[model samples]
Target: MSNPAARPWRETKEGIALDVRLTPRGGRDALDGVETLADGRAVLKARVRAAPTEGEANTALIRLLAQEFGLPRSQVTLASGATARLKTIALSGNAAAIATMLETRLGAGRQTG
Candidate 1:
């Protein structure tokens, strides 16, 4: 896992706001782990099977995150970077729980950025 102070997610009013470096058409749908970017920004590494077209990959990402976080699709929304590789995902629910879950899950799947 990356440094705790540099983790890519933060507790928001509703839940957590996550910075993700998404790879569409990534062969398989999975969260690789957490890493710090070249500029020192932390991001979660995630790959989706769906291609980046007609919002398919975005939808797939939402579904993936929702499923990963055990939240409904409605709770997981793209907060920014719709057409870019780096996306900000907003997860709505218990902020603390979601943060803990993200930390635990990402730490378990940790990988170098």
Candidate 2:
């Protein structure tokens, strides 16, 4: 199988672009794992307890990602999909370091469809 983490994010001059699949109003806020879609695209799966109303889930997701990657909340921004389950988040930092951190935390074997 392809490395899910490798496919979900890409390095850019400013930072890294992350593809995320979010589940709002989940029991708790947490990183579930990686998920491969039917189209073979991979995304990082995360859940937030916050409801999907008035950007609450979006804010929670940003906070969670910032905390996970040790970046300031200001450094993490929603790049796309503001009101959708799939979102693209841009993190302003070293792409390589961010990728390494995510790989270490999520692991290669942890993937769900």
Candidate 3:
């Protein structure tokens, strides 16, 4: 069986790549947890209070992630999907350490409906 904790992220030479599903214009910014899609892809569910206009939601997402991972905003970047709800985020740092931090904060395992 695949490790659930590792499902939402992939290790990269520079650090780690994370797949995130964002809910824009949410009442508040928060991490909803890991969600397994119908296609069996796992993504970290997050919400931001900012509206999804002019990249506000995307900026908030990066901020939220930076805070969650205890990293500077400069260390987090949107790797792809800037205009879509599903986004790819790249973090610059130690891959294992970031993975461990993700597991600790978001819990280990995949969440499926």
User: On a 0 to 1 TM-score scale, where does candidate 3 land against the true structure?
Assistant: 0.91
State in Å the error of residue 20, model 1: 0.5
- lDDT assessment of candidate 1: 0.86
> What TM-score does model 1 achieve against the real structure?
0.89
Clashing pairs in 2: none
Choose the strongest candidate by lDDT: 3
Off by over 4 Å in 3: 1-6, 110-112
The C-alpha stretches of model 2 lying farther than 4 A from their native spots are 1-6
Error of 2 at 64 (Å): 0.9
Candidate 3, residues 1-22, lDDT tens digits: the string is: 4485447898999899999999
Task: Point out where model 1 deviates above 4 Å.
Answer: 108-111
In angstroms, the error of model 2 at 34 is: 0.3
What would the per-residue lDDT of candidate 2 be over residues 1-113, giving only the tens digit for each residue? 44544467778898888899999999999987888888877889999999999999999999999898788999899999999999999988888888787677766567887
lDDT of 2 at 33: 84
Q: Candidates' TM-scores?
A: 0.89, 0.89, 0.91
lDDT of each: 0.86, 0.86, 0.88
Candidate 1: count of backbone clashes, pairs at least 3 residues apart or interchain = 0
Tens digits of per-residue lDDT for model 1, 56-103: 999999999888878899999999999999999999999888888877
- Candidate 3 all-Cα RMSD: 1.9
